[model samples]
Target: MSGTSDLEFFNTQLRSFVPPGGFDAHAHLYRREDAVDALPRHVEDESGQVGWTAYSRALERWMGDRRPIDGLFFTVPKPALDRPAANRFVAQEVRPLAGSRMLLMIHPDDDPADIEAAAMSSPCVGLKVYHVYASRADTFNAAPGEFLPEWAWELAHEHGWLIMLHLVRVRALADPVNHDYVREHCRRYPNARLLLAHAGRGFCGQHTVEGIEALRGLDNVYFDTAGICESEPLKAILRTFGTRRLLFGTDFSVSEERGRCVSVADGFLWLSEHNVDWELSEFGRPTLIGIESLLALKQACRSARLIDADVERIVCCNARQLLGLRQAATNQTQVTYRRAKRLIPGGTQLLSKRPEMYAPDRWPAYFAEAQGCEVIDLDGHRYCDMTTSGIGSCLLGYADPDVNAAVIRRVELGSMCTLNSPDEKELAEVLIELHPWAEQVRFCRTGGESMAVAVRIARAHTGRDRIAFCGYHGWSDWYLAANLSDS
Candidate 1:
C-alpha cells in the first residue's frame, strides 16, 4: 500500500515524535561492487548495484529529519561473497559515523584468532551468526549451538562482544531441545551477550511471548524488533523485556522494500541461481508481499501505548548500554537533565538532592514514590533508605503509619479554614512545657526556611550586620551573605 521512497508519508506520520540519538540495532552497509565478479553466474548480474551512497540516501530518508542515526552495520550473508572483504568495507565506510558499530558474520570453520585479529584491526563491536546461511539451508531449521564453535564464544567472552543471533526453527521456544541448547550455550559463555534477531523470528504474538519466556533467566539475552510489526507481539516484548533488552532495528535495505509492491525484475526476488523463483513460488502463482517494517513499527508502538521513555530506550538506550557506549547514548534522562541545568539555577530545588550527590552520571535523580524508608525510582526500581532518612527529618522513620494516620485524620476534619487548628497551639504549649526556656515556637515545612527565619530574627534582635553560626546552616541568603567577603 506504500510507495517506493515514501519519505514524505513517513515524515507526516512521525511529525508528532522524534526520538533523538536513536540507534538502528539492525542495518546493512557494504561495498558490493567487487563481489559481483565472485558471485555465481546466475545471480552475479544482480550484485554490485547497491552502493554506499544510495544506502546513505536511504538512511537519510529513513531518519526522516536528515539527522544522522547510529546503527549496527552488517553485510548481507551470501555463499560466494568474501566475508573478510565485506567486514573491511563496513569498518572503513562507517569510520566517519563514530556512533555506528559493526557486526561481521562468523562461520564455524573461521579461525577464532584470525577473527579476533580482524576484529581488533577493524571497528567491529561484535559478530553475527547467520544460521541458515552457515548451515547451507534454504531456511533456518537447525539448532544454532549445534554448529557455532566454542572459540567464537571464548573470544566474545574475553572481549565482551555481542552476538547478534538468529535462531533456526519456527517454534524455537516450544522446542525443548532447541531452547535447552541455546540456554546451555549462553550459560557456558556468560560474557558473550546474545541479541536474538526478529524476536527469534516468531511470526505470531503468542509464539514471540513464549520464545522470550524461554530465555527468561538469561540476563545477557536480548531481542530486536525489525521485521516484526505486530502490535500484540511488540506489546508482549515490551512487557516481558522492559525495553532494556529489546533493541530497535529496521533491518534496513530489506525493510526499505518491505510492504511495497515489487516487479518481477527485482534482483532479490527474481534473479537467483538457487531456484529463486520456483523455490519461492507459492504452489502455483508468482506473488510477492512486502513487509512495511517501519510504518508497522510506528503503528505498533502507538497501539501499545508506549511512552517516549520506552520508545527512547528501545531505539537508543538499550543499544548504547549493550555496546558500552555510555558517552554516545544520550538518553531521555540525560537530555532532560542537560536542559534543566541551562534553565533552572543550580539544576534542582534542593542542593542535596542534585544528581551530583549520588552517582551523578549514573544515579536516577527522580522518584515516583516514597513510603516507609523505601523509594521507587523514576524507572520503577525500588530501593531501601539506609542513608539518614531525609536528612534525619523522619525520626520516626519514613511514612510511619501513626504519623500518616494523624495527618490523614487532620485532613479529613479540615486541614485549613477560617481559623487555625487547635493542634498547632497545643503543640506549641506542649513544647514550652517540655522546655521552659522555649517560650515561643514556629512550625515551618522545611529546615532551610526555618533557618532563614531564625537568621532574620537574630539580625533584627541584635541589630548587627554580621552574625556568627557554626555547622551547615542550609542554602539561605542570610547564610550566603556571610561568605560574600573573604575571611
Candidate 2:
C-alpha cells in the first residue's frame, strides 16, 4: 500500500525486517540496568511502558516490521567497567552478529586490544563510538582523548575493519586538535577507514565552519546522516569535502521523538528528488505516499549533493573511496553542464533536498520532443516551448530552410577556429557599428571562457592583479588563486 517514495514502504520493512546482515555501527544498547533507567527518558509516552521488555518489544516490533537491519549499533549505556563489562555487554546485545551481521561500539577509552581480541573470538562486523552521548555527558568526546587503543589502529587497519565513530560537531570537539588526532590515527594505520557519525554532529553547534574546515586535508574522514536537519550546512560540508565522503544514515533511534522515525525520515524523503519540497512531505509513519514523490525526492538528492560536485563528492564517491568500498558502477552519469554549475556549483547540491533542486537534471526527458510550441516527456508529460528559436539556435521549433542554410554556411566556412576567426573581426565591426561608442568586442563561446576573459580584461584595464569572486566562476584568478594567491 506504499509507494517507492513513501516512508512507510521503507519503514514498513524496517519495522518488520532488518537488512540482511547490514551493520549499523552507531546505535546504542544499554545494559538492562541502564535501559531501565534511560529508555524511559526517550520512550514515547504513547508507545507504552519503558522497560527492557517494552523497549525490546518496541525494537523487535520495529525490526519485525522492518528485520535484519544489516546490524544495529548499540552504544554502552554508560556505567561500563573494564574490557569485561564492555565485552559482556557486547556478548549480550551485539555478539549475535557472529558470522556476517555485526553491531559494534567502542568507548573512547575502551582498550582497543580487548576489542580486537573480542573481534577475533566473536564476530564484530563493524565498530562504533559515541561522541553525541559524550557531549550529553558533558565531555568533549565519548571517551578520553586518543580514545582508540594504541594497538586498535594496527589491528583494525590490518583487518580492513569498518570503524564507526559518533563524531558530532559538539562545538568543543570539532577542532584541529581532534581532527589531527583522527588524521594521526588514520596515518598510524593506513588501511583504517572511519565513518564519522552525524556528519560531525552540528545539533546546536558546539563548533563552527572553522571547526569543520580544520580537517580539510584528512581524506579518510567520512560523514553519515543522523540528526542533521538542514541541507545548507550539509551542502557546505559536501562542498568543503565531497559528497562521496557521505553516507546515508538515519538515526532511527528517534522513534521516541515527537514524530516517529518514519516521519522524520519522511521529512527527509524530499531530499531524494529533483522537484520535491520537504514542506510538502507527509510527516508520519505507517502511512503510505506515492512513487512520484519518492522519485522526485531522490532526483533532488542526485543534484543537491552535486551542484558543485559536492553532492557527488559526498553521497556517492567519497565514502566508498575512503572506506575502500565499491559502488555498483552506475551507468547513469549525473553530469551538470556549465550553466547549472555556474549557480549550483555541483548544480544545487544538498544531502537531503527537494525535487526542485534538481529538475534541470532531467531536462528534455521531463518533456517530450518539442514541436513548434509544445514538448512532452516519456511519462506522457507535456509542456509549452515558450521560447521558440528566440535565441536563433533552431531550438524548440523555428527550424527553417533559411536557418539551416545559415548554419550550414557558418559551419562550412569554419566559423570556429583554433585561433581567432575572421568572423570575429567582422562581428566586432557590426557590434561597433551598432553601438558606435563601444571600443572593443570580445568573442567567447562559453560562459566559463567569457568569465575568464572578462576577468583578464578587468585586471588588465584596472592594473589591479588581485580580485575576488564568490560563486563557481572558474578560470578566474579569484578562483584559481583561492588556495594559492595572497588573497
Candidate 3:
C-alpha cells in the first residue's frame, strides 16, 4: 500500500523548513500502464500505482499549509517500454504545470536524430540517461560505450542539452573511467552540461567530495543534492563548490538512501528525518545532530559558518540559475581551536581550553602565530600573553627562543624512532634525580592519560578499585565516569 507517512510528515513537520519557490532539481513522472505492460510482475508498487493523477494530488497535499515549490520533473523510463510513450506521458501530464520543467529519457540504442526530434517536440530542457536498469539490476558496471553509447553524447553535444547522468561505475564518479569520461566529454563539448546525480552517487564518507574534486576546473560540470542527507558530504559539497554549482534536488519518486522502489513522498521525509552529523559517536557526548532532519541542511550551513546569503543561494538561487531564471554572486578566523571544532568534536583535547567555557562569542578562538609572549590572530591583531598561556601548557610562555632551539636540535637528531632517543633515558634520570624518593619516571602523551596511568599503577600496587581525589584534576574516564551517576 502507498504510504501516507511521507505526505503527513512533510505537511506538518517538514513544510516549514522548505523555502518558497525552492526548486526540486531532480524528480520523475512515469506512466503506470507502461510499467505494468513492459516490466516483470516481481517489481513492487507496480499494481498499486500513483500515476500523474496521484502525483498531482500528492503535490497539492504536500503544499497543504506551506509555500509551493517549483520542480524539475523527468520521465522515469522503464527499459524496453516505449520511450516515446513515456516522454509523451510526461510532456502531456507534467509540462503544463506553472513552474515545472521536463527532461527527456534517451536510450543507448535509440536513434539520436529521432530522439532529438522527440525532445524538440516535447520541448524538454535536458535529457536523462540511466546506465543501470531494473531488468538488469545485477549488472552495475558498464563500459562507456555500452551505457550511453558515443551517439548519445553526439546528440546532447549537438543540441547543447543538459545531460542528467546517473552513472553506474563501481566507485560511481570516483571510478577512473567515469571520471575520465565525464571530464573529457564536458571539456570537449563545452555546450553540453553534465549534472552528476546524487553527488555522483558516492554515498561513502568523503568519496563524493573527493570524486568531485578530481574533476575540478571544468566550468561545464555541476552537481545536485538529490537523495543526499549526510552532514559531511553536504558540507563538503557546499565548501568545495561554494553553493553556486550545487543544485537542490531530492530524487523524488525514489528513496534518498536506496535505489529501490518507494513512495515519492517518502524521499522528502527521509532526508528531513535523517538530517544530522551521523559520523559522531553518541557513547558519552551529547548528540550534536538535531532531531529535525529536515532542518539539517540549514543548520549545517550555519555550522559551516555560511552566511544567510550563501544558504539562500544553495537552496533556491543555484537552482534558479541552472534553469536560467535568476542567480546570485559567489559568497574564517580560528587556527587550531576553530579547525578542531569543525573536524574534531569538543574542539580541544582538554575540556578546560574549550572556548565555550570562556567567553565563547568574544574569545579569540584561534591564533595565526605566536612568539615569545605575544599572539597574532589571522587578521594580524596582536595581543600580549595575559591568561593561562595555552591552558597552562606553555610554562615558559609560547615560542621561548632557548626552549624552541633545544627542541629543534633534538628534532634534527631524530625526536622519535624505533630506537628510543637518548633524551628519553636522560629525562627519566633527571626526573628521578630531582624527586630523589621516586625510583623511576614515565612519559605519556597527555596529562589526562598520565593521570590515568598513575591511577592504574596505584590501584595495581594496592590491589584496590576505589580511590579518592581531593580537588580538580584532568579529564579521564576513570574520574568522569563516576560523574555519570552523580545526577
lDDT of 3: 0.62
| Model 3 bad stretches (over 4 Å) | 1-16, 34-53, 59-68, 133-138, 255-296, 327-487
* Winning candidate number (TM-score): 1
* Candidate 2 per-residue lDDT over residues 354-381, each given as its tens digit: 2344364554323323334444343323
Alpha-carbon lDDT, every model:
0.66, 0.47, 0.62
TM-score of each: 0.59, 0.47, 0.54
Residue 44 of model 1, lDDT score: 17
For model 2, give the 10-residue run with minimal summed lDDT.
Answer: 260-269
Give me the runs in candidate 2 sitting further than 4 Å from their true place. 1-25, 34-36, 40-68, 81-112, 130-138, 141-146, 167-174, 205-208, 252-255, 259-439, 446-487
* lDDT score, candidate 2, position 482: 36
Top candidate (lDDT): 1
Q: Order of all candidates by lDDT, from best down to worst?
A: 1, 3, 2
Error of 3 at 21 (Å): 1.0
Indicate whether candidate 1 or candidate 2 has the larger lDDT: 1
Stretches of candidate 1 above 4 Å error?
1-5, 33-52, 66-68, 133-139, 260-291, 328-487
Positional deviation of 168 in candidate 3, in angstroms? 2.0
Candidate 2 differs from the real structure by a C-alpha RMSD in angstroms, to one decimal, of 18.7
